[model samples]
Target: MQKSYEEILEEFSENLKVLRKKQGLSQEFVAGIELSVRNYQKIEAAISTPSLRTILIIADGLGIHPRELFDIPSLKNRPMVKEITTRNRKSAKKKTTKK
Candidate 1:
């Protein structure tokens, strides 16, 4: 079955948000670089469909390759492991020290 245009746009928007977050940037920051706060927000919210040139501009502002924006993965739904604690590290060091 073919996907609807809205669905495709939504997915693209989601991927854009993920890429922006991965680059440690806020919408305000991206807007500053792109020179339009409203435009950035509209793209992120999927309220307005972005042109290919606009997508490329956004990707450039976010310091990512344009191809990265459309490379969304389905297996990223798994929970990520949090950082290790100092106590956990100490325990691990002790185990390794004895072995």
Candidate 2:
């Protein structure tokens, strides 16, 4: 089976918090440089998903590569991780096939 959208976001959010805390950085300190506190909090809360640029900025703020943000081993396999990405597969295929 495939993963659902919500599951992915929830995992990403959890990963973000874990990575941040593991580095001993404060949310305020990280947000002050490239993002607003509210926005960072929202991402950590899984209430909002960050764009590619935001992800890069966040990774930079954390002193790690962007890919490290998604270093969760559980994010792989199972038709794209658990079942959070299944419904979007059709739409994603459409984008690649259209052009």
Candidate 3:
């Protein structure tokens, strides 16, 4: 299923946080790359959507490919996504059992 814009943003936020933590970097450091700390906080919190340019800037600061920020395994398999899939499967099972 196609993810909603909000979902995509949420995924990006979570992924960015994880990646930044993995690199042992602080928000202040990441934000120093062409963004104010408040703006970076908004992006990381999913309170604001970032443009492609901003994404690239952040990736550059993190020393990673911009695509890596969005296409990470953790983002793709987020807990909410898995939970929804599990619920759908259970509902389908119930329907089949009813028939």
Candidate 4:
């Protein structure tokens, strides 16, 4: 089954929090550098969808690769990752069958 947009947003928010805490950075520290406290709070709370540019700024503030924000290690066994992994395996099976 596919995840709803809201579900994905929730996952993203959880991922954000996990990564931030893992690095021992407070929300204030994260916001103080490049983003506003309110905006960062909203994003982390899953209350808003950030633009691509905002994502870039966030990744920079987190001192991580931008893609890491999307593919979180803590969420590797979560719904989104499971769904994607299942889909990829299905695709690979199809390719092999067609060969």
All candidates: TM-score: 0.65, 0.73, 0.69, 0.70
Better-scoring candidate (lDDT), 2 or 3: 3
Instruction: State the local distance difference test value for candidate 3.
Output: 0.87
Judging by lDDT, tell me the better candidate of 1 and 2. 2
In order of listing, the candidates' clash counts read: 0, 8, 0, 0
Model 2: per-residue Cα lDDT over 1-99, one tens digit each: 455777778888899999999989988876766799999999999999999988988888888888878876456665433355666787799999999
What tens-digit string does per-residue lDDT give for candidate 1 at 1-99?
445668767888898898889889888877665558888889888898878888778877888788877775432332231234556788899999998
- Model 4 worst lDDT window (10 residues): 72-81
**Runs of candidate 2 exceeding 4 Å displacement:** 78-99
- Candidate 3 per-residue lDDT, tens place, 1-99, comes to 557778878988999999999999999898774898999999999999998888988998898989888784445666787899999999999999998
Tens digits of per-residue lDDT, candidate 4, 48-89, equal: 998998888888888998898888444446677678889999
Against the unseen true structure, what C-alpha lDDT does each candidate score?
0.76, 0.83, 0.87, 0.85
Q: Which stretches of candidate 1 lie over 4 Å from their true place?
A: 73-99
lDDT of 3 at 40: 90
The CA root-mean-square deviation of candidate 2, after full C-alpha superposition on the true structure, stands at 6.6
Q: Which candidate is the best by TM-score?
A: 2
Q: Could you give the candidate ranking by lDDT, starting with the highest?
A: 3, 4, 2, 1
Clashing pairs in 4: none
Clashing residue pairs, backbone N/CA/C < 3 A, model 1: none
Please report the TM-score between candidate 1 and the true structure: 0.65
